[model samples]
Structure formats: structure tokens, C-alpha cells
Target: MAGLSQIWAHIYTTTLVFFSILFLELVILVRAAAGSIHGCKNRPITTTQYLKLVEEKNPACRYKTGLRMESLECAVCLSKYEEEDEIRKLKKCNHTFHKDCLDTWLQQDWATCPLCRSMVLPEEVVVNYWRHQNYQEFDGSDEELIFLLSALHGNYIRRFL
Candidate 1:
């Protein structure tokens, strides 16, 4: 047992490093899952809406091509956008990318602008992210929930006071 103890003493630093790396990886995975709001939950965008989003791009949007110093490029594909190229401009963030490129990226559950990671929910996309957070199930729409909340708030305040 003395020989075994000596061996462990020599390798303990290596064992500690391995476990530290594993703990760090686990922390990273948990944080990533927490940040992934729509991951595996929201439905993909429709072709028509994707096309409409593509048309709403700011024509003056420009990016450096490294060759020309002034031009537009898709952040996802890193390809230069020509005059007739289809591009999608994300609102609120105003980041632009190739229509096809953004469509593919958006289909994946992140639902954010690839370049800016901003929330990019379209008007038609009705994702109630709070659906899973509710303690009680209600039979009405989100608008009704808002109306019911005020009454609940008054009851809570009166009871507490």
C-alpha cells in the first residue's frame, strides 16, 4: 500500500486537472442550455415570411469585402451580396445576411440574428416562452392572462396588507 500511495501522490495533480476540466465543461453546457430559450421548442419560419423578411433589407447596408473595402456580405456565409442578391434584415438589430443562409440558421432553435444574437421573432411567430413557466394552466389566450393578472395582483396585495 505504501507503493500505491506514492503512485497516487505523483499522479494526483494530473487527476485534479482532469476533474477540473470536466467540471468546467459541465458548467459551460448548463449555461448554454439556459441561454438557449427556443431550443427545440419553436417552429421554423415559413417560406413566404422568410421571403418577405428578405425583401425588407436596407439596400444601403454595407460590409467590408477585404478586397473592395465597401460592400455587403452575409454574416453567416461570409459571401458578398450583389445588387440582385436576396438578403434578410433582422429588425431591432438591423443585421443582414443572405436569405437562404439566414433561413437555414433560423430553423435551428436559437431564433436569433447570427451576427448579433438579438431576439428575431417575426410578427406571425406566436411563441409564448412563458408557457412552461406558468404554475397554473389557464384556458384563455395571452390577452386574457394579462386581464386576469391585475385581479390576481389586487387580491394578493389585499391579503398581504
Candidate 2:
């Protein structure tokens, strides 16, 4: 059991490194979940709000009588609009798409127009939402933190580290 003392030192170093890595990884995951990955600053919106936005931002309805509908193709699906097809116009860029298609696109955490890549929502709206959201850092305490913390306030950490 003469070599047992050295083993304890090795074990302590390994444990410290593991906990540090774990804490960093948890921080990364939390930020990613809040829609901060890849510099995506687009403000996320809810489905209910989208209903009002469509009408408020303005929408284009292609009323067909005898004219060719080829000019009214939805950029999203790359298909021609029919009489019953719902149309939504983005007020910013004046680009239009099928309502369902645009909704699907927005739900993917992107707030830009599919064709022009312009912001679908206004800057003020995003700013206001961001203020309310106040995406704070993940400060929640967990088992890893607890374990590392306990090791810090004396006893095992003081003796081993």
C-alpha cells in the first residue's frame, strides 16, 4: 500500500479536470438553447403572434379571375399559387410567400425573408422582445457545481489540491 498515496493525488487531479470541463460544457449548452448559436440574432416569435403579424405587416392575396397565376409563385415551395392558396406579404422587402410556408420557415429560428434574407420582423419589435427576455446567463446550480463547491470550502479540496 506504499504507492496508494500517489494514487490519491492522481485521482484528485483527474477529478478536478473533469469537473472543470463539465462546468464549461454546461455553460455552452445553456447559451445554445437560448438561440445564441452561430451569431443568429433573429428574434423568435410565437405562432399566435404570427397570426396578427401577417395582417399587420400586410399580406398579398392573389385574386385570380382569368389571368395567369404564374407570376405569383411562392419562393418557398417554388410552386404557383392557386385561387385558394393563402398569401402573406412581408412589409419590409415587399416579398411574398405562402402563409404556411413562411410560418414553417419562421419556426426554424430564422426571422429573415427566405428569398432576400431580410428581416421579417421590425427592429423595434426585436429590441423590445430582447429587453423583456433579458437572456441571462445560466447560473443554475447543479450536482457538478455542488460537488466542486463542496471541494472548494476546505476538506478534500484543501488536502488534495
For candidate 2, list the clashing residue pairs, or say none. Answer: none
Q: How would you encode candidate 1's per-residue C-alpha lDDT over 59-88 as one tens digit per residue?
A: 324333442432367778897776666666
Q: Candidate 2, which segments miss by more than 4 Å at Cα?
A: 1-45, 60-62, 65-70, 124-161
Candidate 1's TM-score reads 0.36
Q: TM-score of the candidate numbered 2?
A: 0.44
TM-score of each: 0.36, 0.44
Which number leads on lDDT?
A: 2
lDDT of 2 by residue, 2-91 (tens): 589779877976787678667767867886776665343465444566546645666656546464433578899998778767777788
Candidate 1 — which pairs collide?
63-71
lDDT at position 82, candidate 1: 68
lDDT, candidate 1, at 153: 45
